[model samples]
Target: MFVSVGVRFEANVEALNMVETAGNYSKHRRVPYIIEEKNVLKIIYVPAVSGESLAHAFQELLAEEAISEKQKVCRKCLRGEFLKSMDEENAAEKFDGGKLPSDAEKLEEGIVKNCTVEDIGGFLYAGKPPVKRTSAFQVSYALPIKKIAIYSTVEPQLHARHAVMTEAGKKTGGEREGAAEQMIYYVETGTAIYGFTFNLDLRAIGLSAITGKPIIPEDELRARRRAAVKSLARMLSSTQFGAKLSRFLPLGGIVSLAVSVTEKPFTLTSPIYEGFEDMTLKRLEKIAKEFNEQYQYYVLGRNGLETPEHVMTQLIQYLKERNTL
Candidate 1:
């Protein structure tokens, strides 16, 4: 069975900008938008998120959660706790007179042969001139649910120490700088929504180079998809999202699925709103209904009017009903 899944989530944040561009204020200062001419008479600048950012976020989440069940797997690299490998590489380089072995040499000498984790799979196979895997997932750029507030603030930064230098036989130092101020622009309040779609085709993604397998089993794909979707929901509260400036707390999210017996894939480009959470079900149903008229698909969403768990439950139920649990 093939499935086309679309997901969207709401995030409540003090400041969150999915897309940032350099501003005229300073090279370091960045804002979420840029001015563009709508026509010969008018120009507009609006807050918008790029699809690239959402794609990257989802990719990171998926990579983090999707564990390759291969013989050679590095657990440390999978968790992003790869300090030991880095230290080992550095030590090896130091031992090799500050020059690491080339790719040919490393392959011939079998150095770090066991580092074939999913995270570094590309690098491991780089020697063969890698082939890219077209991602089955696609996400749209996020936009404000309604209105967005863009403002700037000036904050003071203090230097802890002054630069000191010893030239010749005398000690010299630059004048001590007390503090500096920086102008920062932020999105005060707005819930951004993005449209995302996943096209799951085992033939396109299931090939195993290690075993020379042509397809991945359906059970394994279901498990991976479940983990990935759960991780996607949890990614909003991730501490590494935007650090201090943006605190994107998880509000809620909805994911609807369209399972087909055939291989035809459909894309979901519908818009989602934050405050109008009830409409999520209605919208998904409408889309599913429209798509079902042309092709066979099973549609499911939350049958309630609540927040937080509504979307999560909808996803879980959808998966369960489809026997993908």
Candidate 2:
């Protein structure tokens, strides 16, 4: 049962950076590319966002949630436990290789025989191995419908240190506080629609082979999918990424989850909204009708538009019915 989601978000000074340092001109934030489509020599800057940013934001939120709630993460391997076991294994090896047949040798033998010790000094220590699990959640680059403008401004800040000219001044280098300036860039207000999808196919990932665990139980997979959906709903609401970017909150957006009733794997994405007004039940209905005859949708926001309350209610009901919640 795979599901596709379409997202439309309103930006009030929302900025997705191309590089880390937005203040530096060399590393100023950019969508992706600036190009021209023409027979004549011309150039155009295309404003776009990266899917990596979206994935990172969600992943950071998940890590924080796991830490705060004391919940175990299912998507990644337990690095802490693995590290501790490796440390013990290393200590045992050191002791076993010593001159005397000591108690550490017996301990080493026990550890070597332990079921948890899968591949010692093999793929674990050598090169970077590929990801084990396929991420069911995905996000596309957010490209604005209309042309966007970028504004650059320099702000002053106080610095705690300063440079001296002479060697004598350098020797007496004390706190010479001074004010510094830096330039910041921001994208002009515009709406960008980001496409999303969630593939529920488990067998394709080969989870059992990667994690050395049995096939993920139905209940667990359902729980993971539910969490992923909840995280998507909270993408704008949660400000773990930054309060400034998603500051104004999502004015309105449409998220549809089309679950296949049959055993076959299927996915369906809603049409990308060119503008906020485009997010409507009619658009969602078209996607649902085209993708799967049997499916459910959750429409959010009542910003001067006709929005049914039962959409959310029905979403919850369907989740409960599917034993996902």
Best by TM-score: 2
For candidate 1, the TM-score is 0.49
| Model 2: CA > 4 A from native | 18-28, 31-43, 64-71, 74-132, 146-214, 239-293, 301-314
Model 2 TM-score relative to the real fold: 0.51
Instruction: Give every collision pair in model 1.
Output: none
Query: Where's the lowest-lDDT run of ten residues in candidate 2?
Result: 115-124
lDDT of 2 by residue, 56-75 (tens): 66655544333333333422
Which residue runs of candidate 1 sit more than 4 Å off their true CA positions?
1-43, 67-130, 145-175, 180-214, 236-264, 272-302
User: Please, what are the lDDT tens digits per residue for candidate 1 over residues 172-249?
Assistant: 222222111223443333334433344443233333433334333566545555654555445533523322243334
